[model samples]
Target: MAGGHIEGWSPESLEYLDACPVCGARTGQELLYHGLRDKFQVNTPGAWDFYRCGACGSGYYNPRPTPESVGRLYEAYYTHAHTAPLEYAQLSLLGKLRRILGNGYRNYRFGMHERPASILGILAVWLMPDQRALLDTGGRHLPKQPKGRLLDVGCGNGDFLLFAQRAGWEAIGVEPDPKAVEVARARGLTVHLGTLETLHEAPESFQGITMNHVIEHVHHPRATLEHCYRLLKRGGWLWIETPNLDAQGHARYGENWIGLDTPRHLVVFTDRSLLRLLEEVGFARIERLPYCPLCERVYGMSRALAIGASPHQSPPLPREERVLARQAEANARRRPEIREFIMVRAWKG
Candidate 1:
């Protein structure tokens, strides 16, 4: 760990940008954050710098890790282990109950009311219609039938694919992480080990595409969305979710905000910035969904970690330590624009 550099990020591993990757705006750029570390990969060296575009108001890394060296940054990434493929046979009684609730909640979220085949699902959905949002497994806004193929970009370990499959959607995924792809394939999922650029196929081949928390990591946001538009069928849906730069957590935690994962999260977007990117790519019928609670959890967890608190840190955090997270979530409720992340659903024209 000498010089604070990660092992595989060779000295030759960084690409400097001359213009905004989103809007291609070269001038009117302002420095946003500097000396931001890869706190997720605490071993990574050399602080990262980010700049904001005055034209589009999007924030991005100035010197991002090159394609060759970026893989090293994700080595031993926690998501691979924590989000392990769903283990059905090993479910405890409570786990089984959660599954039932999750299934019912999924249906409720999508405006479907199919009679649940199981009694558990019936009771769960019937007894607690208001809790549908919390119980949902999160493939919201999907059609009821498996009409066509759906592509999930950066579909790490294919957890969402599994959920989509259960909901009757044909699921395919492309992931650059080989280890994660392995886990996905073991579950009988049709997952390829590479980025979307590796897909050599006709345009309009997919019925829908999703990139949850993935777009910000992309080197070129506009190019990625254009590719998405090309791959999707006419009128097909595209769901893109990413961290919001306007969140109060950024103001409170500064560099320690978990959303600003430094070099990894290259482009952070606000609602307006994200809308512009999608619309500029010819997407139509754009709609904004409710804020993701995971964003609040990120701030809470990051705060705990910052104070050296254990993962099992007892609830009811100290008043002083908890103020920032509470205020951020309150802001999220009051101002949707300030939500920690934005999930946009749009259709390809």
Candidate 2:
């Protein structure tokens, strides 16, 4: 097999898998993409190949960076930066109204106590399904578990940890990156400085566990999920969100899809394959959450990539692309498998 070498890392440093990571099938593998570069970050130097498993419809990089070397790819990751909360005084009138209403709905639904909230906000948000969906996602779809313990794997600067803390959960995080862990700890969060594999939390300790866009980056996704299963209480919930291999964005842009962030994303799963994995892992009451309003951002970035433009520095998205994004969003609502990302919540039964 042909491969690209990263600087300072020999070919032997890359781990080549002989079987499909998701299903363990080795006989029927098909090469879907070759010579794919890290277009989004542009920091990793390599032309990677992505293969699709005929048995499972999942995708993975064969010669992916080993556990020791993969940290180099995330040296400049977005999670290293600390995010400040929006100040109430700095918001425009409309922004303030939206914030107030959002807070109100959160307080009512998630048992939060955010200030400037009004009881009317619940009715207002209930009338807007799209906005409600976004709010639920922001809250990780976990209902308020008063004094419940929550663990965020790959917590990344602890943004969600802060949110969960505010929502009445004892939120703790596990992060691998030292920089990100430092930033998260500076926020006064109780974050364990390592991956889930290295986390020494007692089994069945957490009421809820969440992994947002973290599973694909792990060297062993199955092991990660199994660890999460053991960490949650028997009736606790586990939430996960990752890029869907069979998304409309992939169909539209193919290799240029922003979801395919090169060697960083070791495995990209389809909805069916992900569901199967969850079932095999002894999770029950699995529910697929609705895709949030993200088509514009995803499609815009993909369009920028396709046109050889930096997604961050590119001009405004074209009107036609916006139209296409709206159309895709509507299509995803009806046929959820086509959504750009897969979000699921399951119970450890």
Candidate 3:
């Protein structure tokens, strides 16, 4: 799994960088992981190298896939799956109750007027903090705006767009993958088939822009942030969720950490590095959002990788591993930096 040319890729398809893509510091870079392969997909050939930037505390891949060849890695990506939304009529009695309660809470918190919702959902959601947090995340923690347009960048299959549209925002998406775009369009979503730079909308056209697990995949993250800043209206917000390089999972699992995601995730950011980048890009009032309940899934996937098990196969996690994952998640509430993912919300001044 190390030191071989990737299948269907030539030497020129890779690009080597001498400096940190985040801070442009070359001297303090340290090799974090060497000969990392596509453990999850097991589709891409050849091993890759990951390095940490001492200056900014970010992680990145060197001799990474160039923009031209990178598309090959996503040919069988998860975004291509067009999962149909669950219908209310298909739910069991308890399932329908939970849905109604969840919808009720969403209406109360996010101003959505979902049918079959009851005010009791607020109390029910409050009783279950994890469910409340999940609802907040599903809404992107956005407060009720004046029904302005929301842009979802790298919007895989337009899942969030549908949610935002139902929540009363004029939701649109930008997706680069043709298969993903086609799937989203099939769902009657408005999606542009290109990157953010290729979007023909006027500057400051959106009231809010969201990028979920999308920033790390881009070739130029700084430029991407700058573009997002320009695309948002004055006083608008940008929400970003990406794998944290300084995560506790990375510390525990090392190269087997799912966040390493070789070749696909070109750059991984620590909280400090990401906050600095947002400020540098002219974003004001930048704030770190609370971590969600994803430790079990992240740890489970990392554990599967450690045991040479493909996560896509849905390997069963042992009871001990689940307990440890829960412990890690509880610990993250006190030590937020140890969270598996970095969630950030920044505002355009």
Candidate 4:
């Protein structure tokens, strides 16, 4: 099932990376999987292959889309679509309840607010889980420092920046997509139009830095994290969210795991591997959070499509979401390492 070429770059622009991006080891890398697809969206042409480093157990795409050709990989990307800011007041009672539950759990989980508002809040805190990366989507996890400088790497459409601005942080972002940058700029956001590798900001300039679903897309994740390390002040926080290679969905779905994202998700990390990378970058006080709901939703969609489900379907007719959620919960209770999506927070020390 070969697909068409990318929009702006030729196939020849793709490059093969032989060395392990995390450890810089040239040998002892083993093939982990093959024939992954752009299953989440766009159904792009070409099968992608993934390999794991024997030294670090970190996984990455071998012949990946080069930095130059990468732009073409996202031409039909959904993030470029303009969307109005959400109006939460208009949400239904159930939605509002869920929001409250989510927020209560977040505050309690992060030790931001130890006392619950009520019995319901306590129950909410107990039921709902925490993922710092997802919370950053709404700027819910901004540092206690008022008006502190925060940077969002690969911030698309400035949605998070808007939330951060409202939360009293000086929000700025770096994005590579011209259309996404245009949309963010239209919203009056301060966004640099380039990759983090190209952005040369002053050292220790930011109090908090977030990379939500962005690290896996970079060609060299270690280099990107190194840049993040240099950009953060001592004791600053670095939040990262990416696909988990040890996720239960990957165990169940194999190559069709939605989080894989084939060619786009160049690197995938397990809990141990990601923790090691953070430690190597001088990040301390690290915390690993729960699986993101988006990963489960995406896994369901991928399962549906794999079984010949209609592409026009909105939610894709629920394919084992609840079952997988229960399975993930059970596994996390036992090992806490096998779950979809890696959500972690560490401090620059």
lDDT of 2 by residue, 210-304 (tens): 99999888878788888899999989989999999999989999999988888889999999999899998889879998668888888888889
lDDT, residue 43, candidate 1: 73
Mind giving the per-residue lDDT tens digits that candidate 1 earns over 19-122?
Answer: 88888888998888766776666677767778888998888887778777788777776546534535656788787667656655566454444333244664
Candidate 1 has its poorest 10 consecutive residues by lDDT at 1-10
Q: Which lDDT tens digits does candidate 4 get at residues 1-349?
A: 1123543336688777768877788888888876656665545777667888888778888777878878877887766876673456866887667666555654543334422223365465444454443554345356545447999999999888876775567879999999899999998899999999778789999989999899888888888898999999988889887878888777877777766776788888888888988898788779865444454465665576577563336354354566665656666556757767777888888
Better of 1 and 2 by lDDT: 2
Error of 1 at 104 (Å): 3.0
**Clashes per candidate, residues 3 or more apart or on different chains:** 1, 0, 0, 0
Clashing pairs in 1: 4-45
The residue ranges of model 2 lying beyond 4 angstroms of the native Cα positions read 1-8, 312-314
Every model's TM-score: 0.85, 0.96, 0.95, 0.82
Q: What is the C-alpha lDDT profile of model 3 across 127-171, one tens digit per residue?
A: 988888888987888767677999999998988998898889999
**Stretches of candidate 1 exceeding 4 Å from the true structure:** 1-11, 82-97, 107-130, 135-137, 308-316, 320-327
Worst ten in a row by lDDT for model 4 = 110-119
Off by more than 4 A, model 4: 1-12, 41-43, 85-140, 290-298, 308-321
